[model samples]
Target: MGRSFTVYVAVLAATGSFLFGYDSGVMTDVIESPNFLAYFQTTQTSAIVGAINSTFSGGAVIGSLQGGLTMDRFGRKKTIQMGALICLIGAVLQSAAQNLAMILTGRILAGGAVGLMSMSVPVYQAEVAHPRSRGLIVGLAQQMIGIGFIVSTWIGYGSLHAPETSQLQWRLPLAFQVVPALVLVIGMIFLPESPRYLIEEEQYGEAMRVLRKLHFDGTNDEWIEAEFFEIRRTIEAEKSVAVQGWAPMFTVPQWRTRMLHGVAVQVFTQMTGINVIGYYQTIMYKALGFTGNRNTLVAGLYNCVGPIANFIFVVFLLDRVGRRRPMLFGTLGISLALICEAALNSQNPDGQRIGYSIGGVFFLFAVSVIFSMSFGPCSWVYMAEVMPMQIRGKGNAFAVGVGNWAVSTLWNQVSPIALGQIEWRFYFVFVAWNLCVSFPVIYFLFPETKQKTLEEIDLLFAQRIERIPDEMTQREKEEAGVSAMNVENTKLHN
Candidate 1:
């Protein structure tokens, strides 16, 4: 096994992300369905409709917190499987619902499942991937998410062609979510656990074997060995100092700073208004003069743009360009696009001008493209990379749950109502956030972590004590404190 094998495992794990994307994106079409509205007797702006979206996110918040514990206790692979199984159950409830109550329950359950997967999948991918390709590997989370969005939007569009009276118009897309969830559950059985995780469990022999399998390139045994020992030494150092429970995350200054960075990146990611656009772009298109099937069709095309842009960035630019620049530039770009959208929407208040409609749609697509290349993948990568192994599961989950889902829940609940009551004004909120808050925070605070191993990332946040050389006597090793070879390596890499 080599790079290809690592990629294979990463992609398989990303099926969890696909489910996350699909569940989130499918609702855009579901609520738009005339059959769904008629069957449930709810309009798009109804509080019930908002409840449907918000409940899922609310569930995810819970799932994310729980997933952190589960991932740590059961390993990454099993946690994903658990999430998929729960997703299957949620899909069934959603597809067969007879009233709003049932569907909302399903939405909450599905949301929880997504939350669990969201926290687990990226951590697993980051831990397993090679440093040189880590950005590409971890970025797959957002890439798969984009694919999930594309599939959901197209399926939702196609489902609209079904008889208006047929529940299949909404039910079919809801049901289709099970396919990927099922695949993730079964496919994970064959994949290996994270080597970092294995090391934490004191399974050094197994950890070494996994590192070799994941990184072996016919002649990189020396590099692989070095990485294995580096990981083991770092983990040992962390465990020796680690306090039990989640206290250290908040109490320690370095850990607190990392937690803030992780949480802020995710908060900024959601505040960029990607989900608001993804979940309710049909409404935006309607305001832009798209009617009937045109709105859904354009939404499908809009969803397609993100994946292509993200794919290009992940493969060609992510590691090369590094993280900080893309985020800084991406936030600025998203702000500009939202401004254009607001301006164009204001101009086409009646949705009568063809030019304004085109402009509005263009800017919408622009938001998706810029976000895909920048914040969409980078946020997940940053959160996963910043945490040490001792706290990664809980810390990443907390960031994703509190920052991503909690904020997402607020926006998803309010966006439709805001669009109904305030119209184009809501776009400005995100525009202001991007310009005044998100961009500056990223530029001033975030450090570049490109092409560095996970152990090396520790040096960026705090200074480590010097380590004795391997050739030193045991007494000398005890006298020298813990490992600091990575500090010198960090300097050399810089």
Candidate 2:
């Protein structure tokens, strides 16, 4: 795999994220459509409607938690294909639903598919990408999510007018999710499975073949060999522990801390309340008094801003800004935006007309812009960066399961009810929580990983640490660690 091929694989792999983003954003407007509400026999603000939307997230939580085991057992390509198959089932069920129970089941299945992709796709990208562009490849998952967001928003907007008696308003948008999933599974068949996964299973010949295919530009044999040796040594160090399964993740202090950092970043990412917008933009606009399709369009347009911001961030800011600074700085921006938006809503001087006002709309877009540039992409990129190879799948699943799906599901379950009950006051909770927790956790716990290789990230988190030598590549240094393990094996032989 040369540069173009690596990007080719990455782009197709990122289609799963497109599905994730679409499923996440599609419901935002569809759930608010009068036709949809009438069809489902539920009100815009009804608890049943909230349950309908949140149930998808509930399914995602399950998909994410179990996704790691499935990926570990079956490999990345198969895991993603399974997710696509399930998502297709969900899309069909949702399109044909006549009652809430049917749609709810569909929502769960769709959510499960998103959950699996959320955990597996990023790990797949991280494992295959060159360290020079690893952040960029991992960041593509986030960028595609933004693309998915824009696509779903436009789809919901276009389908808003299907006859009340007709189900196409919601049905078609739900059905459209299958296209990307179908493409993803087909494309994955032609792509290679992760070489890292191959090596872990003692498939050395296959792993070498993959490394050569990927890293050999016909002139980089030395560099490829270095990468191979580094991978080998890391696995050797991992095997030295002798603890299998989940136990290895916890037995080491650094690994434990790295896992926590992944979780903490994920927690704060959700706590920033971005998904609230992803799931509820139309309702929020309605509450702000932008009535009818105008409100829905505003939500769609507002969503459009995020993908652009995420694109710029990934291309320019991601590798440049490192992780902690952007996260902390962006958290502050999120807090400010929340406070401003909350204040604007609290005034409600002219009531719902605020959605039409320039100042009011500006702040709304501002919040999205800040979150898009900072928390939206950074959280996923940072988590992928921090997790070590041995436990990357399971470790990431825990972060995504707990933060993205679990916390998001819980929020979705109660937020409609909360928004109906509390209105502007609800935003204040996110503002204060972000202010209180984000800076402290990042400042105290997280380390910078801007230009470091994945193997060097191992060095950063290693229990018996030393400075990364100036002259030696991490691959060269890892040879020493492998030597120790080789000696241990020799002793056993004697």
Candidate 3:
């Protein structure tokens, strides 16, 4: 068991992310269903519709915060199982909803479930992954998200064929969320707990066993021993200074900086206006002159573009290109696309021009393509990898909960009204944010963490360096006949 095993566990854990994507994406088409709106007796821009979207995000905020504690107390694997179970319950309620109250309640529960998994999955992946492939492993969270979006959009598009009054159009998609939730719940039973967590719990034997299975390549016993020694030393050092329960996140200067980076990346990800398009792409398509099933059809096709780009980035570019440059490039590209979309929308305010509609759609796809390659996956990757083990669960939760879900709730609530009343002008808000705020922050503050181990990242942020001990270096040299410089380099690379 080596890289293959790690990938297997990461993929299984990402089913939680898949549920998050499905739950979030399913509503894009659900609210667009004519029967759904008529049955609820509400229009797409209605406050009730906004509440439906906002409530899920609101629940997610609470869930993310709660999940941080849950993962810390019970471990990453159990937290994921708990989230999946909650999602399953929510999916059942949503599929059987008879009124707005019922549906909103279900969405709230589902949102909580997604929030829980969103915080847990990436942290789990980062903890288990070899540093050489951590970006790829952690980035799987976003790739699975893109896949979830694809599946939901296509299902939503297919549901358009149902009889006009059939509630199945939305109900079936809502129900479909249950399948992945069930898969995630069961899959965790076979997965291992994070070795770092085991070490923190003082289960040294179990931790060593896990490290061996995760990193062993038959002739790397010395390397395995060296890594175990480093992890134990770092964790012990952290334990000596670790404050109780979230205080250090705010009180410690280095931890505070880490928190800022985590929250800022997530907040900026939302500010990119990706969800504004994702959660309401059908509505945007409608405003662009698409009618009936055409809205869902175009949305289905549009949803496909992001995942393909994201997959390529995660596998080939993420580690090679690192995090900062891609984020800068992505934000710049998104700004340009948004500008183009705004001009197109402004030119075709009446929604009568085909060329403008085509341009508007093209720019929308451009935004997705750029975002997928840059911020979409990188945000999650950066947030998960940046924190110390002690604060990782709660710190990540705060960032995702406050930065991602809280901001998302605001946007999800206001976007329908904004798009309806202001139209093209709404695009400028994100453009300004991208150029004035997001770009400058990444350029000035963010440091490269690619190809660095979790412990090394700790040193990087703490403004200190922790070299491998001379004794350990000599031991490795004697045991494996590896040079001290070669051993140090391997440690840094991993």
Candidate 4:
């Protein structure tokens, strides 16, 4: 694709990511409203509160699995369109919710659509984008998510200033989720379905048309064909050993390891206590004695840091610094930050010592910065990068369905109850998960995928390098032969 067109598709697809963030972040501030609390009658049992928060996560698990079937069958563009339409339905229900049951149902409905988009967008973007810049292209999904986080928080903060009984405070924010969903639905009508998806469905003529539109200015047939040939070879390879369902993910060692890495990266990121803070920053702020707009303002400022950090990481850091190092350091930084937060809060377990929470707030903000730098962008990016071309849609859906959505539900459901019961000590759970689980998973298991093309990553895992020194050299030699064929075809144009 031309650069502008490429970015247009990426940004439009990434609105799914944006919605995911908006939905997650919207409730954070809304839950703090007395009117909402009063209406829900959830003060005595935080599980109802937990249900309101986690139902979306719970619904997302089903949505993600549905995405796997629909994305592969209907193509990426249509699947995304379907997701947006579903989200709009959810938004309408939420905007008009009369009781906690209605709002919970709305969130669950929206979660399914968001889950579909979440699984499809990155896959669509990766296949459509040039491999050289694919890291940032796919990574943009997460960056837009950070942008969504910002937009949702600001929406919540702005709504706080509205008339107390106007109902706009919470209702409007829930309604606003439709704006992005509507935009995505409209935009997809004009865009092409993923060329890769077309090829998989045996639509070669359409695939070539898309390839020409995506990779060149319609004059560079040689360049477009070269790219398509690589895709063809990979597809052939994938087809040769393809298993029916999830069996391949666990049966083949190479596939097993990559699948585990994809699943682990996702599960560990959620386990890092992000939901505890993300879902209930206002509660934490109130616990620390910051009342009213002071809490909203601080939460806004804290969430603001995320998108900025993510932009810097995806733009300037990812392709150059590679994935593993930054993720490892980010995990360690988050672990230490959690330890600091735990220690700071322990001094005021009852939150009566709110006078000394300045350090606690700082550590909380620090965790935001570090989390954005590493896991926020990288987790989804890593998941998208590691899956195979033939099974990319279904495989990614499985990983996100079980690892990301299921565990998020598990954590989000338990958090209100856990944090209420355990208080500051709850932070220790993530501290332990990071130390004992996340750190080792990234360090020992996750392979490096910096400048390597998606195809090369497949080779790296499939054809193991027992000797580290020959790894890059051997792969490049193989890639060079393919490059020579492409050069021969394009040399005349130059």
Candidate 5:
């Protein structure tokens, strides 16, 4: 296989991301369906609607937390395959639901699968890609995520209008998501395991063979030797670090700090109100008094456009603009846009500004582009890249699961309050959330991981190796318990 082969493989793995987008976005349309209220029997008194909406997030949390262990133990390919199967099952269950519980059950199962994919796909890609092209290749994961959002938004909105032919309306859109999962399962059967994973498992010959395929030039023995050593050194280093399970992560300050960094990034991504727009755009529009299906249609169209724009911006400028500046600049843009949304929404009452509501919707969508191109995809890349490869699965899983479910729960819990009390002012909380947490996380805690090799990054946390301090903060002091040998170990293979 050529470089194209690996790229295509990444594309296939990333296709799982399409399902992630679809499953996540599926509910956006469901909320608007006439059948949705009757199907769930939502009422002012009933908590079922919130339960129905939050259950999937709850399930995703379970899935994401489990995904890291599953990926490490079972290998990325099998874990992904399992996730796909789960997705298919969830789709069938949701499509066949007669009551709220059934639909929620289906969503829970599907959401879990998506949660798993969100963690696994990038881990797999990062493990396989050549160091030189790593950024672009890993970035494809985000690109697919954008595509996934766009696809599901369209499906959710378009299906509402589909002529009633054997339930081609809403059910068809939900069911159709299964096709991608099914294809991923079949395709993954032939897909190779991460070469690094194979090496860690002491399947060196197989690892070498896989590397031969990934490297594209089989004759390059020196490259193979360096790659092989790189894998081996990482495994040896992990042995000293005590990276397994929750114990190592919690006890070691350095480990815990890194984990916290992961959590912070994930939390920041959510606080940006990315999901608020992606999931609840229709409801938000309705709050502005834009009635009928047109609001949903417009919201969906915005999602589709935003991702395309995001893909173009991040894909091209990622190298040129560098990580810190674009993310910081973009965060400022999102905050400003969010403030505008909050202000616009604030004006809706007292009939003070019926004029601003429509403009606010447009502004919210504009904020979507800022998020999609900058924080949206780039955040995932930073998360996967920053964590030490040893506990990457757990770190990523924890961050994503916690972040996603937290947002889902927050939105479900507070959306009603926001709608009921200060509907416009509701977003103000998120604006504050973004400004306070996001900026510092980027400025203080996070490192610029772009264009660096994994081993070089390991040195950032090593004791003896003193790299230049980032303008943001001192090079994080390696914890006391991290012995000389441990530092040596990280330095040896990374």
Candidate 6:
């Protein structure tokens, strides 16, 4: 029963991610329909279209920041439930939108909800999971995001292809997002609060109960107690060093440094133009070579590939290769692939050659796979792991929020314009964005987070370890009555 309960909660919480993907990807099919656009002319409709598309992204940024603060105050379950309600509202508005403004309003509300779910779900999973399984559990949210993308793309494709009388096509698909949001709200109502949250509130007994519930194997209660104590101690250690609000996060050297890395990784991931691929693949496929259902089929295939790649990489290699290396390799590889596509597209300036266009689109699909296995899922897992718990919620929210806004501003708006005007240069922009910023961010800002406990990662910034020790060697320092390397190193040598 305990194990079932835990699994159920994880599955239910994952629905929020599905809604995020659905809303983002649905537009790909919707945008192509002449009926949909005939209602809104170019003169008055462009701003509303941008507003509708960008609203969710903008809301996600705000929601992410608010989610962090709210998760601390109102438990994870409630935060997600609120998100579900917001998604329901957004879905309804989108399905029934008479004007572009109502659609934008709906997207804003839905986006904010997804923002909260993104932060709260991983935090809850991390707090409840065993130390050995922590990476896997927290990584579940990443995997689910991929799954959400796949499902949304296929559904959108099928819906778009249904008979002309089938209002069920787009309308039903958009409405379909509401069902998952509804499930999340109901399931979360009975879920337990994170043990860490309970402990923070000084309710040790309840925290223990939640711990026992999560770990059903009758694992030693002593281990749980020790973990609790360690958590408390770490929180205390962080109190002196942890920055509060924008001042410390933006101004303090160490926090600002880490925050920059957080921000950069997210930006790189976005500029990889992955979401643009997810949301615009159908259009891109049609533009390049494929048409009608063939394009939709290819788009669906591309969507399916991303999550599968993510599952394999995250499940098998994440802990092995660590965070920074994968990110470096992924961004570089994606950049090169995009460069190839850019060159190909540039050669065929008119976008008329079917063979060349198809080849370029295939290369783009390949790039998506590279991103999926490397940056797509791994980046979020790394971001969640790197920030200190003290300001993790807020710091990540702010960093990711900025990235989301960048995505919404660039990918959402620029994509249509780029496709309409400078098609070849579109790929160039993404290629340059990745090559220029990706390496510097990984080299200087991002820290190694392989095999280290979350508690240990937090200490890196608090102690300001100019030179970070490998996780294996870091343990040796703990044996000498210290976690950091300063005084403990001399004592160990003696």
lDDT of 4: 0.80
Model 3 clash tally? 0
Best by lDDT: 1
> Can you write out model 4's per-residue Cα lDDT over 1-494, one digit (the tens) per residue?
57668878888889989999899889887876666777767662288877876789888998988987888678899999999999999999998999877898999999999889888888898888766667778889988887888898999899988877768788888999999999999988999988887767756567767777776765766756656555555665667667777677778777777777787888888877776788887777766667789889989988888788888888888877777887898879998998988787778765567556777788888888888888887887788888877567777888888888898888778887776788778888889989888898789878887766666678767643222221223343243333445533543231
Per-model TM-score on C-alpha atoms: 0.95, 0.91, 0.94, 0.90, 0.88, 0.87
TM-score-better candidate, 3 vs 5: 3
Off by over 4 Å in 6: 1-8, 42-48, 163-166, 240-246, 349-352, 462-494
Off by over 4 Å in 1: 465-494
- Model 5 spans with C-alpha error above 4 angstroms: 43-47, 162-168, 217-221, 241-243, 349-355, 463-494
Global lDDT of each model?
A: 0.90, 0.80, 0.89, 0.80, 0.72, 0.70
Pairs that collide, model 1: none
> TM-score order of candidates, best first?
1, 3, 2, 4, 5, 6
lDDT of 2 by residue, 1-494 (tens): 57778888888999999999998888887876777888877886788878987899899989998887888889888898889889999999998888888899999999999999998998888888887777678888988988898899889888887666667788889899889988987888999888888877767557767777766687665566567656666766666654557766677677788888888888898898888867876767766777678888898889888888888887787877777787888888888877887777777744555444545566778878888788777787788888887678888888898877888988888888887888878888888888888878788878887667677787776652332213334454353333333322332100
**What C-alpha lDDT, on a 0 to 100 scale, does residue 480 get in candidate 2?**
32
C-alpha displacement of 467 in model 4, angstroms? 25
| Candidate 1 TM-score over all chains jointly | 0.95
Clash numbers, per candidate: 0, 3, 0, 2, 1, 0
lDDT of 6 by residue, 1-494 (tens): 44556666666677777777777777766665445655555421254555666777888888888887887678777887888898888889888877778777887888888887776677677666665555566666777787777777778777777775555565666677788888888878778887777756656567767767776466454444456555555655556465556577777676676777677777888888887767667656766767777777787788777778777886787767777788888878888888888778777766689778878877888897898777766667677766666666677777777865546555676676566577667877877777787777677767787666667666655643333222324543343223353422322110
Q: What TM-score, to 2 decimals, does candidate 4 have? A: 0.90
Score residue 71 of candidate 5 by CA lDDT.
Answer: 84
Error of 4 at 166 (Å): 2.9
Per-residue lDDT for 303 in model 3? 88
Q: Give the per-residue lDDT of model 5 (tens digit) for 201-270.
A: 7676677678778875655545545565555666666655554576766787666677777777777778
Clashing pairs in 5: 455-494
